[model samples]
Target: MDFYLTALVQGLCYGSLALGIYISMKIFNIPDITTDGSYTLGGAVTAVMLTNNQPTYLILPVVIGVGAVAGALTGLIHTKLKVNALLAGILVMTALYSLNLTIMGRSNLPLSNLPSLFTLVDISTDTNLNTFWIVLAFIAIVTLFIGYLLKTDFGIAMRATGNSESMIRALGVNTDKMKIIGLALANALTALSGYLITQWQGFADISMGIGVVISGLGSVIIAETLIRSLSITSVWLNLLLVLGGAIVFQMVLAFTLSTGVNPLYLKAVTSTFVLLIVGLPRLFRREV
Candidate 1:
């Protein structure tokens, strides 16, 4: 039970990344691979700031700002330089690794003595329970804010730019700027996840973000399935489904670990599981 609760907290922490993915991949139609780097960059920045005894509240905004800048760079490279979107993201992600290393001055930073947002409140005897409520409250706020943003004209423009860039461009919308804003928003959310998880996990590793995008994409695909099944066309409901999906994904991973499989194969297993999630539904839909 405690294990599952831990998974729930971890999932909620990563739910922010899934929301970021939703904005970039699902809404903006960009497979912004910059997530891989920005995620670690967030943790690295936060860890460094915390090490220097920076205020907890100030670290998040800094992380978000850096992530947004990284994302905007990718957007500019893709839009102005005409680099392929995927290649631009790869370039930014590659650059971020060195940048993160430079920021941390080491491959990992332990936060054993630092005070974190999670440590600020003692909600329960069990640390996992405290994490559960605190992370859930944070996710709720983020979900509501993003959901509300998507209903506004600017958000609609971002969505429309994704749906059909040429059409939006023809309608006097600067598609490049829209892409920049969308990617910035997406990466800001992703960075927040890194910020929270760094403190939650008690350390920040340079490699913690490796392959994180796949996990986030899996959460997104799971949420997409649930939203469709429930006919939940409302923006807020869809975002909630994504959050719930992240929890489910982590729970499923915890269940897998409970089995006697080799822990080294976890990433391979995650890839297979995501493949099934993305493939099986379409296979069944075709059969029907």
Candidate 2:
């Protein structure tokens, strides 16, 4: 139960990033790799803030904002400067590598002495509050917020832009602006997840964000597989599926750990699992 709980929390953290990826990949029709850097950017900002004695409530929002800015910059690089969207993401992620190092003032930052949100609350010492309740609450709130946003007029425009950029442009929608906003929103969510994870883990490693884009894409694919029964695929259902997929993915990880799997092979395991999950549905559908 303890291990499951821990995995659940970690999965929720990853799921939050999945939601961000959904916005970019699904809604914006943009395959973004900036998440790899933005995730660490969020952690770096949160660590720096905590180290400076910033409050938790403030830390979370500020870190999210920092993430939003980073995402917007990436979007601007693509839309405003006429850079290819894919190349823009790579450029931004590369720049964030140095930016994160500067934010932490080193290769890593440890929050051993800092007062985290979990430590402030009256929770059992045996279990981290984040895994059990805080993470759950955060997921719920973000899902609802993004769900609601996607149902609005601006959201429709963004989705339309993804579906058919020329059509949306003919409709008088500023595709560039929409792209920027969508990208900003996506990275902000990714960054926010990083912030919570940093707080929960008590430290931020520079390499923590490696392979994050694959993780997000994997979660999105897994969620689509699990939510096949849902006919009306809206933002709400998509977000819920993301939450579910995150939990499922984490459980798989826990299963691997219990079987004494080598930790060094974790990425290979995740990549292989994603490949199977993605291919399985298509293979079965072909027979149908």
Candidate 1 global Cα RMSD: 1.1
- Candidate 2 lDDT over 1-288, as tens digits, reads 777788888898887899999899988888898999999999999999898898989888887888888889989999989999899999999999999998888988999968886766554555555346767777888888998888999888889999999999999999999999999999999998898889888999899899988878888888777667566466777788887877788789889988999999999999998899888888998999
Each model's TM-score, in the order given? Answer: 0.97, 0.94
lDDT of 1 by residue, 1-288 (tens): 988889999999999999999999998889999999999999999999999999888987898899899999999999999999999999999999999999999998999978998878888877788888888888889888998899999999988999999999999999999999899989999999999999999999999999999989999999999888888878888888888888899998999999978889999989999999999999999999
Model 1 residue 110 distance off true place after TM-score fit, in angstroms: 0.8
User: After TM-score superposition, what is the CA distance of residue 266 in candidate 2 from its true location, in Å?
Assistant: 0.4
Clashes of each: 0, 0
- Cα lDDT listed for each candidate: 0.92, 0.87
